[model samples]
Target: MSDATQNDERSQGVSRRGFVAGTGAVLGAAAIGGLGLPAQASAAEAATAASIDNGARVPVLIIGTGYGGSVTALRLAQAGVDVHMVEMGMAWDTPGSDGKIFAHTTKPDGRSFWLRTKTKQPLSNFLGFPIDQDIPKYTGILDAEEFSGITVYQGRGVGGGSLVNGGMAVTPKRENFSSVLPSVDVDEMYNTYYPRANAGLGVTNVDQRWWESANCYQYARVGRKHAERSGFPFVFVPNVYDWEYMKAEEAGTVPKSAVAGEILYGNNYGKKSLQKTYIAQAKATGKVTISTLHKVTSVSPAASGGGYTVAIDQINTSGDTVATKTVTADRVFFAAGSVGTTKLLVRLKATGALPNLSSEVGKGWGENGNVMCGRANHMWDATGKVQSSIPTAGIDNWAAGGAFAEVAPLPTGIETYASFYLSITKNPHRAEFTYNAATGKVDLNWQTAWKQDSINMAKSIFDKINKKEGTIYRTDLFGTYKIWGDHLTYHPLGGVVLNKATDNYGRLNGYQGLYVMDGSLIPGNATVNPFVTITALAERNIDKIITADLGR
Candidate 1:
């Protein structure tokens, strides 16, 4: 066998078929205390739900149980208004028959994707060998939704993107913040809402001494070493993971998760997703209820009424509609992430449900300039055998070239001298979503070549580091080993943009009491992990909404 092939065998501990066959447990690894565990909460158990098809009228109806929806639910419930939440995906609290709460990133099954027979993994290959396998179609955690030229990976569950992210609670720099959301009050966000949101989410930092010696973060240390060698400022990025728990994990006193290279799917331990944060508080209010497996198919003006009417489909495990329900609400909030919210609004407006919708309804959409690239490191710059899935640092080159590249974790357990990064650059290309009644779908007019701008911006840092270290880019990651995977985005933002599409406080223009409280409101991008900004913006908007608009 070739040296590379031998290395693959040694690193993976099995061949492709062998790894595929051994799936009795989570990721083929024996339960090491805390890996692929901490069952996700079922929607039914997470919050109370009113029976569908019963014609219940709510004061406020929030669609999707994500950051925006959950935050709205909490704030509105705090204001003593009864709220009803609709989520198209399943609740993530329960574990499967395998006695595990989630599937491992390496060994994905029915729990990997949203309605697909084969898994569409972000990390599709290892050592030039394709690692993706067939999975029984089920509503999985990660939804790698594809368009013509790009694949957007979004989470499908109660907590939304928070369920399937790296738990990086990042806020954009103040200098770049105005461009992210110019209409909003900057002082209110940074001084008030950002702090409130971060505190609510339990955002924390890693211990520096522990970070330097922790086995899980050795890959990061190697990255720091190189970034310092190249004279670029390397900085630590805060996370939502519990650092104390991570320390306990490494000490072997607690179950190993981030240390066991568990991320990208979900971390059953040490990581605090929205379920354990906002949604938990929202549930505590007891005024908010969530209905899972219920997809909002149609929304329109109430027949001879003053409120909005919504048509919801209650689907079974097979995605077949078992029942249809209708809800009438005085106010409606769209918290269905960027794609979900935009698709619904675009379809509704185009189909005459809300004809007076602004021309900006489906405009100003972007992928946040996301690009993934890896470099082959020399033996002296070994990235480490054990890599933490949660990245805590990045190459700070945004000042020089408007790119903030996170030194991401490979998390494959067995490392092969490689350094990877997922860069968020300021690529100023925005697309518009057009509704095609023929296909009954929303189409975004974005070209794959649009990513080249981001790639060039990201290369500003990598090219410098490469020249400094005399290394090269990896060829196996995005199709052809050396070529960057420049066509996919984990962060999808904007469609029903803020200020233009909605009033200053997220009230849909020309349609009062119709609000949008999600990442869809951002003009195009957040220039960071969109969740924190999405959360903060939701706070900023809802606080004003509750004070200025509601309780009137």
Candidate 2:
């Protein structure tokens, strides 16, 4: 190992994973407390659906049940405020005919996509053949929403993006913090909110010793080898999955999740999604209530009352609205992920419902500088067939290359001698969301060519490695001749940015009880996974909102 690698490992205490011998008691207690909460929260949300009454009044209402939504709900509920969250997706509590809550990544079913007859796999092709297939149109976990320029993959469930991600809980470097959130207090964030968010999200690094010899991680090893050979820093990234449970899966001592190719769509076990963390704790408080399959259509100041009137639609699994209802709330929070929140706000303003809203409400949207590609390795570099679905490492070349590339897994159940990657670059292009009065919908003005900036930034790292290893780009995974998967983004950020769209603390500029809490508050990108920053910023904003706005 190089000196940089040795220093990185030593600083992280790589020999021991999250569960060290001295921390056995703490880890055991946390497992028993958290591992079973997702199922319970799912069951509770399902039960709450039947009791969701129309025309009911609430003290506080949140638009989405994503990371920011969940964090906001929990903190507000703890501060003696009653919160009701509206989610446009299913509860995901019940098992399918296969006795699993989520579908297998390699065998996608109706449960994989949201209202799409055809499955839009990120890697759309294999061996020069298109791999998408027809599936039943249903309300599913992952939403591959198509726009004019890009397809943004967002999680559509009570737990939001936590339901369908790689569980990579990455925080941006402190030196780059100013660019991530220039208006926020860096000292308070680093000293207080980031740590709280990480603890709440259950972030932990993989055991490096176990990784060195594990068959499932041979792909990561190969990726690290190539990165180090090119003089790049191979850093271990943290995740929200339970490393102990993954070790059990590797030993065949438990049912598999991460080790059995269970990501993208959903992870059946081991992953500590928001359902097992903030959402679970929020439900336990008894002051927080979530209504699944409930989509908010409009928000306006109530004519007869001193609060906001919200229009909601209860939808079925086939994406049909079964009923529409109106509710009043003293306070409203837009916690929907970036796209959902921006779309709703833009439409409401355009239709004159919330016309007083600031002009910046639907501006400053970005795709988090996302791009993907694959490299065909030499015959001697055979990545293992039993690859783990969860990524645990990345190549940090952001300073020199403006790219932080994740050594993502192929997990195709066969060795194809290919190394796949998803690079989060420092691309400086941002798009805007505008109300398309012609189509009666919101449209993002993101051009496909904007991705070229991302492609160049990513090449700074991959090009050097490919040159050193004499490898060629894999053109079969994305399309017949396409080497860059630049059509989509797994991380969607910004819209109602901090200080511009909202007050410095997320309070809407033109409205008093309306708050913007979520990835939409972030301005474009966080230079990393983005969720940890999203959660931490929510933590900071809600603290101030409760004390100042709610008088708590």
Candidate 3:
């Protein structure tokens, strides 16, 4: 398809203006035009028309424009609160000369950095390439030698991890959530937020009829057979791709899109990332002003008011850092994911920028014990192409008192290509986060028991799979044996957990105008994709803050 034709096709059903209006109205309470106000505002102006007498200072300033940050911003804005969003990545939708979107990792090798340089196709940041040799590489937050034994993938642009993560919108089982957070009501939370999240992100189930195709059906059949032989049942997985787009592809109106296949490389055709969803709407609010490429360096009590002064370093497109600006805000929400927020808070606490930070800022870190494993049938062709779309089924072994494992249909769906990957939940492993006195870098050191309880759970589930129709083989490991290797999760959580240092609702216990609302608030492993949960919890926390007018 010609570039112009493809662009037109993508924009066919939705206009830029319509998309923004719908998003803002649905997600936030602020009139679309109210988000552009400065940090300080009169109480009368900040309150929603319905609650004008509440007379509160705008309750939030969200940092990072990822899932949690985006949702929080939209909700607060919708409530008629003035919100300012700061991010370190440039906006997508607008493309460079090569028609590439900068969502993924940039390589040092020019050949791999630009999509035009390698595939001659339009690239979105969601589909990342290896860092080229010429680009400077940092050791980053995670320790490479301790986990996975490979370099980890992290997105540095606008949408954060959402840009490059598998667009699977799987919710954790209720038991899993209760196991880690016994106090929260999972059912009520799910009911309140799941639908909201789905609507905002345009989530839908892949059509079962579409799965009947050779590519989707064969592997699904294999999964069913294995489940029957092993005393397990296959359950369909919910995803976040546009079903209309899928239908168009099936009708031959669109090319074979990212649906029914792996989405990590980036789904040019399916899956909705935040940059296209919430961020776009936040901009339309006209009340919300986003400054991309502005990295927050420090935050402290404001000199002239009862709020905070945020020090930021603004970098230009050429990677030149210049001009430090101190922006003041009445309230601040830290949604910089688990790692980002934890790192910043740790530095602030150690350096005395925010000395009242609780001791729990860097504890209770867990990796959800993620271990990606898969098995192939003996008669199956091992080299056939695997399906690239998200997996549609999962084994509810966890509910039955076993391990967590989901079977995804491979991209090609041929018999030989048929492979089912499993994310085995492990016994909780505890990691500690500490700061280097000299380098100012945070350090994470984790240790776990060799015969952890979660491993035993995985083995029981694997035995059932082995008893079924397929010959089992595991590609990813936990520690050493197929049972021991620890898979690093895209969903890293805890560390600066809620209640430990902050209050039950994420407000810093003794501090004023400080709050955390991201993955860091999740106390431990959730045993599934955590984006939905993170966003939901953030929404809940923001509601409490606004209701109480805590910071104002």
User: Could you tell me every candidate's TM-score relative to the true structure?
Assistant: 0.92, 0.92, 0.75
Candidate 1 RMSD computed on C-alpha atoms after optimal superposition onto the true structure: 4.6
What are the per-model C-alpha RMSD values against the true structure? 4.6, 9.0, 13.3
lDDT: the better of candidates 1 and 3: 1
The superposed Cα distance between candidate 3 and the true structure at residue 213, in angstroms, equals 2.6
List ranges where model 1 is wrong by over 4 Å. 1-51
- Model 2 earns a TM-score of 0.92
Residues 1-552 of candidate 1 have per-residue lDDT tens digits of 755444533433332222234333333442232233223333433432444545877778899988899889888888888898888887777776566566766767666678777767776765455556666666677889898888999988889988889988898898889998889889889999999999988998889988988888888988898888988899988899999989998899997888877777677788898889889988899888788878898777788567889889887544677688887888889999999999899999899988988999989999998999987776556677677788899988888897988999876655467789999988899988899989988998889999999999999999888777766677676554546878789999999889999987888998988999999998777888788999998998899889888743
Q: What is the C-alpha lDDT of each candidate?
A: 0.81, 0.86, 0.57
lDDT string for model 2 (75-97, tens) is 99999999999999877777766
List clashing residue pairs in candidate 2: none
Per residue, candidate 3 scores C-alpha lDDT tens digits across 341-459 of 88788888888888889888888877665544455354433323434455666666776655667665444222233345555465566676777789877777655452255556666
